[model samples]
Target: MAYQVLARKYRPRRFADVAGQDHVTVTLMNALTQQRIAHGYIFSGHRGIGKTTIARILAAALNCRNPIGSELRPLAEPCEVCESCTEIRAGNAVDVIEIDAATNRGIDEIRELRDAARYRPSRDRYKIYILDEAHQITDAAFNALLKTLEEPPDHVIFMMATTQPEDIPQTVRSRCQHFSFHAVKLVDILGEIRAIAAHENVDTDEAALALLAEAGDGSMRDALSIMDQAIASAPVEDGRPRLVAQQIRELMGTVPNAVFERILQAVNDNNSAEVMTTANQLLDAGNSPAQLARQAVRYLRNSLIAKISGLTPESAEGGAAAELLQISPDEQRRAARTAALFTEEELTRFLQTMLRTFDELGYRQEQRFHFELGLLKLVHLRRLLPVEEVLSQLAGGGGGSAPRAQSAVRPVAAAPAPRPTAPAAPADTRPAFSPFADTPNRERFQGISVGHQPEPVPVAKTAPPVAAPLPVAPPVPVAPPVAVAAPVSPPPALGVPPVVAASPLATPPGAAQPVAAPVEVVSPFSAPSTPPPPVPAPAPIPVAPPAAVASPFSAPAPATPVAAPPAPAPSAPGEPASHLQDAVVDALSNAKQGSASDAIGDANFILDGDTLKIQTMLSKIMLGVVVNADAEKILRLAVRQAGGPVNITLLPADPAMKAAEKKAKAPRSGSAQAKAMEHPIVQRAQSLFQAEIRNVIDLRED
Candidate 1:
């Protein structure tokens, strides 16, 4: 007999022999012992993890003449001694049939299967049909056998094994008992391979066995296959093959995990030179860049997991680390050590970068360059400070200063001090929300030359007025005189412009003192350049003689100052009205409103003292847009920028009369589309192309 590979030689013949699938094995064994068998069974999960093996085991158990094991046992073991079991295990059973659905996936084949399932078994008690890779079966094929699969004959059973269960039609899946299998764990694969190596009389180191198990990636058959190759490549000593970790590494086309650990250490040290050198060495040694990237991604993933598991490298033998990182104990230790060198976030970023590098290497032209670049990125990534950290430093005022700063302008000359007889009045309390609380802010914006500044008015100080002499003839007594002061200039501050101050008005003796109105400070768009004209003082109130008694019910009338008419807003100096209009047009054009700018550019702009008038021949829609709130705001801002007048008015240029005159001067002509339709050559071209004219443009001027 030819020497058989370990995969087929060690294939499980009974459910109990299968590893990592006890949940499925136990349930099927119970059903078999109690004689509760379903007509259809669908086994699905990761490949090489016992999906098809379990299906075959179940098939053998169902057809076995004498099934062993009592109710207390985990499974009803198939008795190999029986003739039916022997024949089925040998793959020559007359009643049991195994079909590869990948090749025979069609409606006709399914119809034939449906016809064959109706018949009773030839020798065994039941006729079983096993379909492997059942997901490859066509939807029509599944539908063809749907009714039969739902309610198959009692003498027949259908067993299916697939890697993807979702591809199976819902109607067919609902009619079957679905059992999902899990990937064989690392420990289980390690134990199985170790036992198999010992049984095969092959000498192997612990690391070699671990490497083989890790290479399996959660598949038992894959591990066995790789072990078979490893045993073949091992050196023979004393008629027994000797397997080592280095030999296995060479055979699997992978370097030791320590290589990746060193790279990550370089990353932690922020050594780009070391990282690129390591990548160059790996590539020069004939290892694939894509393969290297793949290995790096895997290592980084394991390291990130180790960091997230919150385990120390020394104690990562058998807890969450062992459960999540499905590698050998040595590899887990390496991952844990790498994780310690960086933070959780840094490890996560490294893993993401390597994953992208691996994906890019699949189609990249210069794989080596990109792979080195990716590793270099890890080094730079280590130097980055977290956003929260940077922000905290900034908020704590420990970070570097901003890139730019503004220097204060020179201070204007100060006005002379007021006389001692005229005491200054108490300063007015501004509201909390007022923007003028800080005078420095105003001076900071003095660079803007848009509107004229208002002249500053000096604050006037008033004293208690003296009472007038009584009109009674008895020699009226006179009150003591009170002294008043003239208005004074604003406080001298740096960067502030010199304010034009006004003189105080004179008053007759014994007259009442009039209070001045509070100055109105407009928006930043407008500021004072000149002071208002002084107003006349009010007339004095009459008083009774000192000897006479005054009326207690009568209240003294309050004295209020007369308000002067508002001064006209000053226009921008040196900026002509036409130049300001052109500036406004340029501003609108810069704002990306080309049509609006063109329409406004053609309109007439006239400045009449403080008022600006705009006359336009645009339509009502265009007119509405020109006068809309947004457009009006833009116009005002443009005017301010150009240092023009703020008060603006818009007027339509007699739309009805203009429209009639334009119509009268218009030439008599056909529409462009109508003229194109009348052309014989154009009609022929349209007929030949089978095209419709959606739009027509006339190049000729009217």
Candidate 2:
């Protein structure tokens, strides 16, 4: 007779024989008793978990020839004595057809099976077809089987099984009743195998059996096979050499817990030499570098679980692994005690490093380099503390570092020193940057520091922005330019005379007009373009409140051959006009100078609104400044310095029109009036209208 391996020798023959699957067996037995069997059955589960075994048992029960009932009904369990049951068990039952779909997965083979399935069973209660690895069938074969699988003949039953349930098509799977099987637990696997070992009369200890069972990973057949191999190799001692864990480790080349403990101790000691030396010893013992890395990960993973759950060694996976690996109790205690050396963060980091080493071993051609460097790296790495602890140390709120340098940790001593009566030194005010010296704003940016940025120089309050606005011809109405200056400002106190401003060419009122000045700019003939009414000395203009009293005309009105009046100084008699202007400009320039200082020069301001506003007549460049944003900023600063702090805004100025009057008496040129009347567009209009041209007027066409 030929020898049978333990996997097949211990194969389950009955549903009750399938261990760890009582849930499935109990349900199936009830279904059999009630005679409510599904014609199409699909069993899905991992390998070596009794999927095919259970399917064969179902076939046997369905085809059993012997009866157990008092009258004639057959039992769900096979009698095992009759021809049908015996032949099926022996794999020779003609009525029971078994197919390895992995080898015969073509559509033609499935079609042939479908045709043969139509025939009635040959001298049996029913015909059964058990197809294994059903997912290996091609799409065409699955499609061909769908119809037959869904509605098969009453005499035929279909059973399908696969390790990979996901690969099977839903169309085929939906036609069948599905049952799922799970891996047997570690305890159950060891209990069964140890019983088998005792029956075989092999004196095996708990350590050897546990190691074989753990290597099984969850499958009973796998555990039995590993044990069978170990038993065969067992040397004879007192009729049987006890199967020892050391022998098993040698056979399997597994890294024992001692190696993991040694590496961890070296890491705690920060001894790179010991870490590398211990790792190499494992490699010398015939364990692969990746396997060593995996062992370290397992050890650390167990430690983490134990630490978090507060579980003792007996209750944790680490205890099981240690017992199975044959690690001595004293060595296990030493390793377990080291768990105190790691914080949660440190444990997490250690696990990460080991996992990375394991992954890199697969892609790296130099596995030895990865193994040596990995353990050394862990030794060199510093342990990490919790974030809260580090923060508290920096804040001087947590316990200080250890005294006398017992540990590597250095405490943060950032608590402030007591301040003296004198103020602390201000941050360096001098500029440290010199690279921008070539730019146009270099001078302005100089002497500016982070904490002490250069402030805009405030305007002197002795005089308001010196403005004397001239009425120019109205421009085509465009979008109003944004005003960046303050209100119709405090009048310029020392520039143009206020009373003399009644006429464009008139001198100061209440002051004698000088005669025979070479700067006489009177034109021989002037057009009637301006009003002749003498506006009061201090009465405000109605059209546009002015930003400054600028000398509007290009012809110099002789530098009033006399010193202008000193500005009204701000007094305890309430804030003076100049001071109010200064205050308002200062507040504006300091706060919003970057955006709001553009209308400083051109604004015809209105000081009535809470926010000073520029009138629309804000016009052409004044004093060679662009009358734009930069100019506006400078002028605002000046007002702030000269006057006092005042809030500034830009609103449209007053819109009252100026009074229009005849031009004052002056000599008129005959040639100029004749020239105006002789123009072709004018002549055509006069002729077309049959009107006479009289007293021609010049519109100053230039």
Candidate 3:
């Protein structure tokens, strides 16, 4: 006989001889024993897991001229001595026809097979058609044979074996008995390889046998094929081939898992130099960077699995670890030891990094740089803390020193300042008392208590029970000189008025203020012949409620106390309002409202009698910022600062209004776009981000 590969030489003849497929074998055996055979059978699973082999054995068992054992107790296995079994095993059976579906997957071939299936057997009890790689058949071809496969004649049987069962049409699959085969486990492959090596009289160590089994990757045919290659390459000793682990490694062109284990150990130690050195050594030894990356990915995956399952060599037997990690015992132990140095998450991240690096090596020009960088990434990734841990540290509620460091660095201002002394009344804890919280009291102005009038009124004879003692005193006539001489440091007993009077423009409220005097000089006609004499301020605009008072001595107050009073409708001041425009523009620009500042800066400012008019041409986007309520308030405040108050009119150019009207008239309805525009959350986001809605997709079902 010619030299035969181990895959073929050790091919299982009877169902009982098949390994790692007891589920399929035992079920087929039961079906044979009961003689409840289906006309159409489909076998599908991983490659080389006996899908076609089981199909052929079932064929032999069905047609055996003299099946083993007696009628009372029949063995479901085929009788090898029978001529039908011998011809089938030798692939020369007259009645059995094996077709390579990959080559003949057209409708014409299927039509021929359909016509042939109608005939009776030539010599055997039944005619059998075994189609290998059946998934390769075109959809048209499967459709052509669907009717025949569904109701084949009793004299014919159709058996198909395919790696991808889903590629076969559902109509064809429904009519056939579909058996999904499992990938042969590592333990089963190891035992089978050991037996084959013994039978072939080849001397092999346990590591060499394990290596052969692992190289198969859970396929008996693949394992046997690798064994054949290993035996051919093994050195002959004492007239027999000797298979060693080192020789097998060289034949496979792969470094041992130990190389990766060492790399990971360096990573755990955060030694980037060692990692790069190891990668350099592996490349120098002639291992391809892409191949090295692939091996690293595999090793990392095994380590991740070991970390997750806590699988050691001694504990890996007959469990998920055995099925998941299909390597030898030594590899499992190596993976476990490596996994111990890193956490499950770190292993997962390492696997992910290597997986990405492996994919990049396929298309990247600089493979060596990417491979080294990928290894260096593993070293750096070890230093990273999980997001949950970081968050816990930030919360200052975790056990690690990270939380302590986080708490130590926190700003002292984060906590409220301690009160020097408690108030006579208990502080209000109600939400209404909070500045941010809304309260009805915030809407209107409150009463103001003036200490004295400018006309030198007499002091009150008796303190009114409703009035405070401080407001009963008359104003001192000599105070203006003392306040205007220079900046005054407030005295301990100086009240709120002294603080206001001590500012740079301390001339009486009615005087031509020093800041506003320059605006008059720009226009001769707008200036008065002589400046108006200083006049006492009018009754200080009614003060806010006591709770809203802004005083350094008092508790923190709401922003309402500092709000500028509404500008009067008309005030005939004797100066042009250019100073007001400059102030408004400067304020807007400093507030980061650049577009608004530009619009205002380009505007024409006219002081007609008592009204101030601002006119500018702006785009619709800029018009929104210029006319914003906050911007309007700032404009009015600037006018108040320039003089008493005046009517302020902002006239956006007609083109801007026309553009805005056109946009508003643009179609909007109850569609997703309209709803998204009108959504409160969406509107708030638009305002906050200064964005507009361009499109909206409705993902909800109709």
Candidate 4:
């Protein structure tokens, strides 16, 4: 007799013979004993997991002749000795019809089966029709079988089997009883293969059996089928075949577990070279890149499970994969260490990459390229250092010299910076904010203080009036006051510039006390010959703290005869002060009055009676120079230089000679201003220019 494949030879005949499908067997057994079986029954499960096997068993139980109970009490178990059971097992029963739906899936076939359902059984009590791969039935055909499937003949039993039940139309499915089957566990497949090997007297080690079981992937028929092929091809020793894992690996062109284990160790150590080298070695050894990718997925999956839970295959996948239990001690240690290397997120990424690579292996023409790229990708994953470890390495600079352990950018720890130094300030110099504080030049307030107000002075009966301050100019040199013996005045008020008084060398020994003195130093811009008439002496000088400079308002120190006033050379009569221009410029330049000196240099000097007048095109330029205190000193020196005291005034280039002559002709007394505005010529001039009268006076009145 010809040999039958283990998949068919070891097919389960009884519901009790089915492995790892207690749910379906129990429900069917209970339904049979109760005689409550549905007419249309469908079995759905993965391929080779007893979908058809259970269908045949259901038919045998329905038509068995030798019953365990009489008339009203039917038996659930089929008697193997009975004719119905034997004929169903041999596939020779007249009343039992098994149709392959993969081929007979047309509507015509479904209609024929529907018509045949009306007839009674020829030799059995009921007719049994089993359609395998029922999902392959056409949509129209499934629609055609709906009525007969819902209301079949009393003597007919319709049992259908399919690997995928979802493809069947819902209308046909609702008319049938459905049962789903799951894949056989790995241990279950291993046990079945061991039993078959023992029955066949094949010598095999547990490791070899584990390899065969893992290769089965999770199907009992596949495991048994592989065992049958491996046994037949096993090397003969003393007329008995020897089976070993190494021989099986060579025959299957399987990548060794050690190759994967080494690659994983490399992944943990972040060693890309070793990872790539080992991967290449496996490919060189005739291992398929696709197979390497898939095995890597499983190996990594086991490690992930080990890290999360423990290192037990039972815990890894409910003891489904028997090979996981057979790993060597080194493999176990390596897996545990490798498991510690990856985090959950990292493991997930690795699994995802491997799964994606396995999928691409079929589509990619160059399988080695994708396989190597994926391995390299895993190897280069950052050396995942713990938080505490990374911090310690940073704290102790010696640890970073090893390979960097960063994924994207290197995690370089920066040393802390040295503390900054604060600037020191002198206590005495620090600015005081209080307004009443006696500190001069409040550092923060730029030397201004509340108590620095200018003191009020009573005008002296004979002293010249003080001039107004000048406008902005280049910094001028200060005049060297010939050691003024006058009392120091108080400092000016906060925000006001200081005023200096002119003082000269002592008078001659025989000179009488100053009474009606010639008007002092005259400004070149002055319009009047003498200073404004003095009224009275200044009030008593004020007193202030000793830390402050002598109060500018303090009484003048009595002058002793320090030096006699120098006598000047007598000038020829009516001599112009033009020779004194150099003397005036020299005095102003020494006084550092730049603006006044500039104006003096730019003007022409002329002598007018006793007064020296400056002639200029623009009067505004000299306005500041004339008001300048230094200009006063320059004018005095010019007066003494021209051989006598004389007042100085500024005049425009175009003189008002005609107006002066007319004014000399028309003036009366102090009230001459009113008479001049009433002149007929003045009225005509006002009307012609649309001008208003401001004031008018005789030039000789003062």
lDDT of model 1, residue 1: 100
Cand. 1 TM to true fold: 0.61
Q: For all candidates, what are the clash counts?
A: 9, 29, 0, 20
lDDT-based ranking, best first?
A: 1, 3, 4, 2
The candidate 3 region of ten consecutive residues with least summed lDDT is: 518-527
Off by over 4 Å in 1: 67-75, 387-702
> Candidate 4: RMSD over Cα atoms?
28.2
Which runs in model 2 stand beyond 4 Å of their true positions?
Answer: 67-75, 314-348, 380-382, 386-702
TM-score of each: 0.61, 0.55, 0.61, 0.56
* Best candidate, lDDT: 1
Tens digit of lDDT per residue, candidate 1, span 1-702?
A: 999999999999888689999999999988988999999999999989998888777877887776456442335778766788888888899898999999999999999999988888999999999999999999999999999987788899999999999999999999999999999999999999988998999999999999999999999999999999999999999999999999998998999889999999887776778888888899999999998998999999999999999867788789877889998888888998999988898898988999999999989999999999999888877776666655554466366333212212234222233322223322432222323235433433322211223343322344223244223223333343212222322232222222222321222335543432212111222222333333443533232222211222112222112232233333443322666667767777677665566556656677777777766667767688765666666776787666566677776767666655333332213435568878998889889998665545667763
Candidate 2 lDDT, 94-199, residue by residue in tens? 9999999999999999999999999999799898999999989999999999899888999989999999888889998888889998887767787788888887
| Best candidate according to TM-score | 3
lDDT of 4 by residue, 1-702 (tens): 899988888888778788878999999998977779798888998877788888888898888886647552245767767888999999999999999999999999988888888999998888999999888899999888887887878998888898888998888778888888987766677788888778777899988987887777667777777777787889998888888988888777776666777787788777888988888888887889998898899878867766665554223333322245434334445465667766776787788889999999999999999999999878655555445556667677455534344544356534434323222233433333434246332222222111122222223233223343334233323332223223332223222234332321112235563432211211111122222222233342222211211222333222321222222333443564455766666677677775566556545566666667765444555465464665765566555654534477766434555344333433222234456667898879989997755445346632
- Which candidate model has the greater lDDT, 3 or 4? 3
C-alpha lDDT values of all predictions: 0.71, 0.61, 0.70, 0.65
lDDT of 3 by residue, 1-702 (tens): 799888888899988888889999999898987788999999988998898888889999989988546662269888777888999999999999999999999999999988888888988999999999999999999999988887789898999999989999999999999998999988889899888788888999998988888888889899888888889988999989999999998998899888898999988777788998999999999889998998898898888888888886568555777578888777888888898887788888888899999999999998999999999988878877766766665466575445321122323212223223211222222212223123232212111111111122122233223222233223323322211222212111112222222221222345444332111001100111222333344333322111112333322211111112332233244444556677777777667765576567656567776678776666556677666888777667666655524578777667646456434533234445677888899889988998876555668764
